[model samples]
Target chain A: MSEKHLQTGDALPPFGGKLRLFAMRFCPYAERSVLVLNAKNIPYDLVFINLDQKPEWIFNFSPRGAVPALEYEQGKGIFDSNVINVYLDEKYPEVPLQAADPLRRAQDKLIVENFSAAQSAYYTAAFNAQALQPSHLENYHKGLELLQKELETRGTKFLHGDQAGLVDYTLWPFLERFEALPLLGKSEYAIDKSKYDILLTYMESMKQVPAVKTYYLSADMHAKFTESRVKGDPNYNMLDSSAEVCCFRPRKKKE
Target chain B: MSEKHLQTGDALPPFGGKLRLFAMRFCPYAERSVLVLNAKNIPYDLVFINLDQKPEWIFNFSPRGAVPALEYEQGKGIFDSNVINVYLDEKYPEVPLQAADPLRRAQDKLIVENFSAAQSAYYTAAFNAQALQPSHLENYHKGLELLQKELETRGTKFLHGDQAGLVDYTLWPFLERFEALPLLGKSEYAIDKSKYDILLTYMESMKQVPAVKTYYLSADMHAKFTESRVKGDPNYNMLDSSAEVCCFRPRKKKE
Candidate 1:
C-alpha cells in the first residue's frame, strides 16, 4: 500500500494471503491492473517497485521484471497487464468486468489495440521531446478521433455500457496520464474540450468512479513526475508522505 | 482455396455466409488462426492477400491490412490472431481449445509472452542476418530450453493436454519455421535432438495432429520461401501449384 517503490536489495514482503500486484507508482500499464482490481472490488495488496532499479524478487513475479505482474498464488505470478486483468476478471467473476458476449470482448480488445499509436505518441512527446514529430501528433489526434467515433457509435455512458468494464478500465490509465501532456508544454497533445466533449465527459465520469477516485492523480502531479523522470532522477517516492497520511488518517477518524 | 496472394487490383471475394479469414501464406500469425479453424472443424473461407500490394477491401476487414483478420459476420471483422482465436473458441464451444482453469489459461499466455524473444531472434536471423548477434542466438536457445522444460513438466502430448490446443497452435507456427534457420546457415538456431529430445518428440506429435498435418510445410519449402522473402520479392504464390492440385485432386477422386 506504500507509494514508496522498493528498489534493489529490498526484502520481498511476506505474502499476506491476499492477491499481490507488482507495480510502479507511475506506470500506465501497472495502473491498468490496479484500476481493474479496484473496479472488481477484489481484495489485493499493492507492492510498488522501482522499475529503474528493480528489486531482485520482481523477476520471480514477472520474468521480465515489468510492472503489473500479479502474484495470484504464493510464489506463482502472471505478468502483462492484459493477461493479469483478464485472469483477475475470470477468476473473480463476482463482479465481471468484461462483456459476456465473445464478439463484444474481441471488439473491446481491438479498441485497445487501435489506441496504442496514441500511447506511443504520448511517450515520445513526454520523455523524448526531440523525437516528437508532426506525424506523431497527427496519429495522436487520429487515435482520439477513432475513440470519439467509437463512443458515438456505441452511444454509452462508458465504452463498457452502463458500467465501466475492462475496456474502460484498460484505457482510463492512459487517458488519465494524457492530461499531463498539456501541462508539460505539449499543448498539441491536449484533448480540446470543443473537439472531445463526449470524451471529456466520459473521463470526468471515470474520475468520479469510486475505484479510480481512490488512486487518481491530478495532471499537475503527473506533470511533476514527468519532469522528474525527464531529468533522469525520477522522484518515485514523492507521494509517500501523502500516502502515509491517507492510510492512517482514516483509521484515526474511526478511532 | 487458392494459395495465390490477391493483390490491389483483385476483387473482394463474395462472402459465402461462412466465417472468412484474411491471411498471408507465409505469415506465422495467419497460420495460427488457420490451424485453430482446422482444429475446430470450422468451415471457413481463407483469403490470402499480398501484404505489399494489399487489396483495398483488406482494410475493411483489417484496418491496418494485417493478416489473420476474421470476418465473422458479413461485413464486421475482428483483427488480431489472439482476439479472433479466443472469439472462435468461445463462439463455438463444442470444441474448446483452452483450459477450463483460468490460472492455466494465464500460464499458457505467459508462455507465449516469454517466448517472444526467440520469435524476434528468428525474425532477425531470417530477414536481417547482418543485425543478428550472439545475444539473439542465446535468447533463441533460451526460449527453446524454456519450452522443452515446459513440455517435460507438463508431460502432455501437446501444450494443451492430450490434444493440441490454442497454446500449441499458437507456438507451432514459429517452431515449424525454426527448422529453416539451420538451412539458412544459422545452425545455432537449430533445435538439437540430443538437447531437446522431449521437445523433438512433442514437435513430431504436433506435426501429426490433423489440423497441422493439412497445412504443415516441410523445412525445404519454408527455407525456399525465406530465401524469396530475403531477396526482397517474397514468392507468396510459390505453393499455388501444389494447393491447386490438392484441392481439385480430392474432388476428382470422389467423382
Candidate 2:
C-alpha cells in the first residue's frame, strides 16, 4: 500500500477483483476500517486519497468524497467508517468482531458514543486551538476515566474478552492518535501512566496486535503530520519514500 | 401508555418484569424504538417522560437523560434511538425487522444517514425559522426525491418490502412530523403529492402499519404541540383525558 494520496485528475487504478478501501493515510476514521479488515484477514486494496484535493472518482465510491468508502464490488461502494466496519464484520462472519448478545452490542456502541466527546476535543485542541476550553479538557479526561473504569469492570486482557474485537478496533485509532496530543503541546491531553495504568497497558497490548502494528504511526510521526495539517497545507505524502527520491539525489552525490 | 409525561417529582415506577422504554411523547428518536417494539410485538412498558422537566430517575436509565432509553433488564439501560432499535430487532429476532442481507442493511442505514439533513432542515424551519435557508428547502426536497427514487428502484410496497421494517419505522417518525411543517406555516416544507408521488404512496402505506397506527399523531396535533413547544410552554399532557376531567366539571353541570 503506497502512502501517496491520489488527488484530483489522478486516474483510478484498475480493479483487481479484491475488496478496495478508499482512505486517507492519516485519517482516524479510515484507519478504523483498515484495522477491522486486517483483523478479519480480508484481502483488500487500500487507495489513499488526498481529502483536500479529492479525486473525482472518489465521489463514485463515496457520495461526499469521504475516505473509508469500501468498493465491495468493482463500482459499488459503502461509505462511513461504522457502516463499512459493521458490514465487513457481518459479511465475513468467519471472524466475528461483534458480541453475539444483542444487548452487549448496544453497550459496545455506547462506549464508542461516550468516547466521541474526547475525539472532538482532540480535534479542537489540535487544529483549532482558539476554540479550546477548560470544558474540552474536562470532557477529554472524563472520556479516558470512563474507558479505564469500563476496562476494570470488564476485567479482560482486551475489551473483547481475550481477543480485540470491533469495539477495540473502532476506538484504537483514536487512542493511538491521543498519544500525539502531548507531543503537539497539548500536555493536558496526555494519558498519564499513574492515572491510566490499566488503559495504558491495554493500549500497549493493542499496539502489539498484528493488525495495529502493521499500520501504527509513532507519536512523533503523528505530531509532525499534525503540525503540517495545522499549517493549512497537509503533508499527505510525508511517508512516501518514492516522493523522497528527488530530494535524496543531492544527498547521494554529497555522500 | 399515558400521554402524560412524568416530571421531576414523579416516583420510580416499579419494574413489571418486561422491557421498558423511557421516551417523550413527541420525540422522533423515541418513536423509532416505539415503532420497532410495536412491530416486533414485544411485551414492553412505555414510560413517557417530560423532556423539559425530566424525572430525576431518567438519568439512571440514560446517562444524559435522553429519551428512547431502554431498560432491557432490571436497572440495566441502553440509550440512543438507533442503538435501542437495533438491540430490540436483534434481541427479538423472531420478528426480524432488518434485511437478511448485510449489504442491504448497510444500504438501509445509508438512506437514513442521507435523509438526516432534511430532518435537520425541518428542525430549523419549525423552531429556528431565522436560520432557515433556501439550501434547507432544497435538501428537504432532495431527501424526498431520493426516497421516491429509491422506492421506484426497489418497487416494494414499503422500504422494507411488503411489510414496514426497521428502515421504514426509523424514518416514518420524521415523515409524520414533516406533514405538520405546512400546518405550522412552513408551506415550503410540504411533501407535495406531485413531486413525491411514490414517496407519498409509501407514506400512506406506512401509516396503516400496526406499529405506526398505534403511536402516530396527525399533522394538526403535531402542529399544536409544536406551537406549544415554540411558545416556551409545552403542553405535554394535552392528550391525557383524565387530566381534562377537571375542566369538564362545569360543562358537565351545564349538560
Candidate 3:
C-alpha cells in the first residue's frame, strides 16, 4: 500500500480513488485528523511522512510542508488539522463528530485553544528538558485542573458527551503523549489518580473507544520516541516493522 | 454608552442586555470578530479594551486577557477570533458568512494559512524594523502573488462570491494593516498597482463592502497608530475624539 514516507527526490506515489492523508507518525496534530477520519469511519489512505527529510511532493499537498494535509481529490489538497478535520466531518456527515449546538462547538474549540500552553510545556519537557521551567509544570497542571472542572460542569463521560467526539480526538493525542512525560523522568507532569480521578476515568473511557483504541500508542512507545527525538533524531517509523531495516542504519543529523 | 476601555481600578461595566465584544482599536485579530459582527449586522456593543492596561474584569471575559473576546451573555464569553467568529456566524444564520460548500470553506482557511507569513512580515516591518529581512519582503510579495492567482482562479468579485464572506473578512484586517506599512516608509511591503493589479482591484472592492467601510480606518490613520505602537505607546484612542482626553493623561503600564 506504499505506507512509507517518500523522502527528497522520491517520486510522487500514484493516487488511488480513496482520500489520502499526509501525516507524521508521532505528531499530535496529525493524529487529530487521523482520529477524525477514524471516528467518521471514512475510507482513507495514510502516508506517514518523515518530517526531517520531507518529500518534495509534500509541498503539493501542503504549502508549508506540514502534516495532516488531506488530498480530497487527485491534484488538490487541504492542510491544517482543524481545517482538515472540519472538512472531513462536513464532507462525510453520516457519523457526525461535532455537536448540533454551535455554542458547544465553539466551547470545544476554546478548550483546544486553552490547552495549547500545556501542549507547549509538554513539548519542552519531553524534547528539551534543559529549557523546562516551573511555569511549564504549573501550566500543565492548570490545564488538567481546567479539564477536570469542565468534566464536572458538564457531567459527561467525555468533553463531547457520552461518546468521544471531535473535542476528545482533538485533545486525546496530547493526553496520550502527556503520559510519556512522567516516564521520561518528568514526574511533575504525571496525572495523579487521587487529584485527577474524574479526568483519569474520562481518559480510560476515551482509550476504550474503538476509533482511538486502534491508533493509540502506549506511554512506553511515546517515551521511546521522545527519547529518540530528544537525542536529535526522530524514529518516525518505530512502529512499522517493514521499516526496521532502515532503523538499524546509523541516523543522520539534519544539517 | 460607555464604549471606552476600562482599566485597572475601574468598575466592570453593567450588562446592557446586548451582545458585547471586547476589542482593541488596532488589533488585527480583534478586527476579525468586529468585521464578522458587522457583516452579520448582529446588534452588538463594541467595547475597545486598553490592551496595555487591561481591566481586572477582562480576565473574566478572556482568560489570557486577549482582545476580541465575545461576551455573548452577561458574565459569559468565548475567546479566540476563529472560535468567536464561527459562533457568531452559526448563532446568527440570517446572513451566512461561510461558504456553503465544505471544500470551499477548507480552501478559504488554507488561503488564510498561506498568507500568514506576509502578515508576520507586516508586523515586523511596522513595529520592529531592525528585525526585517529580505525573506520577509519575499514572503510578503509571495502572499500577494498567491492572492492574485486565487482571485484569477475564483473569478469572483470577492473571495466568497459577489459579496465578501468570512474568508474575505478574515484576511481583510491584515490587508487593512498592510497599507500602513507603505506609509511607515516600508515600501517593500507596498502592494503597487502595477504589481498587484488584480489584488488591488479586489482590495478596492473590499473597501466598498458596507461592513468593512464602517470600521475602516484610512491608511494615514493606521500609519499614525503604527508609529505610536512602534514608539512603545499605541495611540488606541486616536480615531475616537471623544476618548482623546483620556489618551492625553499619562498612560500607565500594565502590572
Query: Clashes per prediction?
Result: 0, 0, 0
Better lDDT candidate (1, 3): 1
Model 1 stretches astray by more than 4 angstroms = A242-255, B242-255
TM-scores of the models, in the order given: 0.94, 0.96, 0.96
Task: Please provide, for model 1 over A53-115, each residue's C-alpha lDDT reduced to its tens digit, 9 standing for 90 to 100.
Answer: 889999998888999999998998999999999899999999999999999999999999999
Give the clash count for model 2. 0
Instruction: Name the regions of candidate 3 deviating beyond 4 angstroms.
Output: A1-3, A244-255, B1-3, B243-255
Model 2 DockQ reads 0.81
Over the stretch B1-255, how does candidate 2's per-residue lDDT look in tens digits? 677788889987899999999988888999999999999999999999988778999998898999989998899899999999999888889999999999999999999999999899999888888888899999898888888999999999999898889999999999999999999989888888878888998999999999999999999988888887787767677788766654224322211
Per-residue CA lDDT of candidate 3, range B1-255, in tens? Answer: 344566667777678898999988788999999899999989888887788878889899899999889999899999999899999999899999999999999999989989999898888888899998999998988988999999999999999999999999999999998988888998778899998999999999999999999889889988988887777877777766576556558875534
In candidate 1, list every pair of residues with a backbone clash: none
Worst 10 residues of 3 chain A by lDDT: A1-10
Candidate 2, position B205, lDDT: 91
Q: Candidate 3 residues A186-249, lDDT tens each?
A: 9878999999999999999989998989889999999998888888887777787677547668
